[model samples]
Target: MTSRENCGYSSRTIFAAWVQGNFRIAAGCFWNTLDEFESAVDESYSCEAAETYKQAARDCVAELTVKLNKAGE
Candidate 1:
């Protein structure tokens, strides 16, 4: 929720793994890029929700909370 203060960050950012291991900035994994996430989203998955695995990519700088359109803009 808050920066460590010693991390030398001027902005607030929260990084979470949520039981995921593979992490990177520009990875093909779900968390990294939307294109990659959408492309790979066709695959069948069980147990966890799609949103759970659709979080930020591993080791990225920060995530954004933008206002999306109801009609997908």
Candidate 2:
């Protein structure tokens, strides 16, 4: 489960959270998914891979942050 295919579980969690109007839960799911990705990168790759995955994770968090903020409005 080290491949990108493993990402679907956490990705699905994010989608499920968002659909349920749970932005915080969605953000948490993103973090957990990113952590799993980072661990995988650390074991089989270099810092470059970790950094790239981190960037994508950060982008996801950023989007979730926006949604969360808007929900408060």
Candidate 3:
């Protein structure tokens, strides 16, 4: 769905920002990804696909949180 497509774009943007040493930008993108997942969950509360996207978003947030902490963000 559109949510999945948007998540992919966000992931790519996050990767690009992180590789360029733009921690803030990367963090922002990660947050955006989370937001997308949250919206998807609200729109399709009982959908298995929405749950999967939410889990992926949570995993990304957890991973990025560690990196952000290390970077003093």
Candidate 4:
């Protein structure tokens, strides 16, 4: 049988998907940081920039928890 057919929507599949989605979010955050670094001539007043990054990180964690809980059912 194929892998999916054998596993049949197992928790492992759910966890893997969750991890993949989180990784994509992290990559986007990294790119955002790089973009800011290249464009920001002065690093002394990057409070707004830091806040955006922190929000994105929080969102990713929240999403991951939701997905994992849903998968448990």
Q: Pick the candidate with the highest lDDT.
A: 3
Ranking by lDDT: 3, 2, 4, 1
lDDT of each: 0.29, 0.43, 0.44, 0.33
Give one digit per residue, the lDDT tens place, for model 4 in 1-73. 0011111112111111233233222231223332343343134225665455444444544565575664344
The sequence of per-residue lDDT tens digits that candidate 3 reaches over residues 1-73 is 1112243323432321133343222223243344554674557455675665566556555566675564455
Give candidate 3's error at residue 9 in angstroms.
14
Which 10-residue span in candidate 3 carries the lowest summed lDDT? 1-10
- Supply candidate 2's per-residue lDDT for 62: 60
Give me the runs in candidate 3 sitting further than 4 Å from their true place.
1-33, 44-46, 70-73
Off by over 4 Å in 1: 1-25, 28-33, 57-73
Clashes of each: 2, 0, 0, 0
| Residue 48 local lDDT, model 1 | 51
Q: Whose lDDT is higher: candidate 3's or candidate 4's? A: 3
35: Cα error in model 4, Å: 21
**Which has the higher lDDT value, candidate number 1 or candidate number 4?**
4
- Model 2 global lDDT (CA atoms, 0 to 1): 0.43
**lDDT string, candidate 2, 1-73, tens digits:** 1112222324332321233333222223243444564565467545775565455544555666575564454
Ranking by TM-score: 3, 2, 4, 1
- Model 3: pairs clashing at backbone N, Cα or C within 3 Å: none
Better of 1 and 4 by TM-score: 4
TM-score of each: 0.26, 0.41, 0.42, 0.35
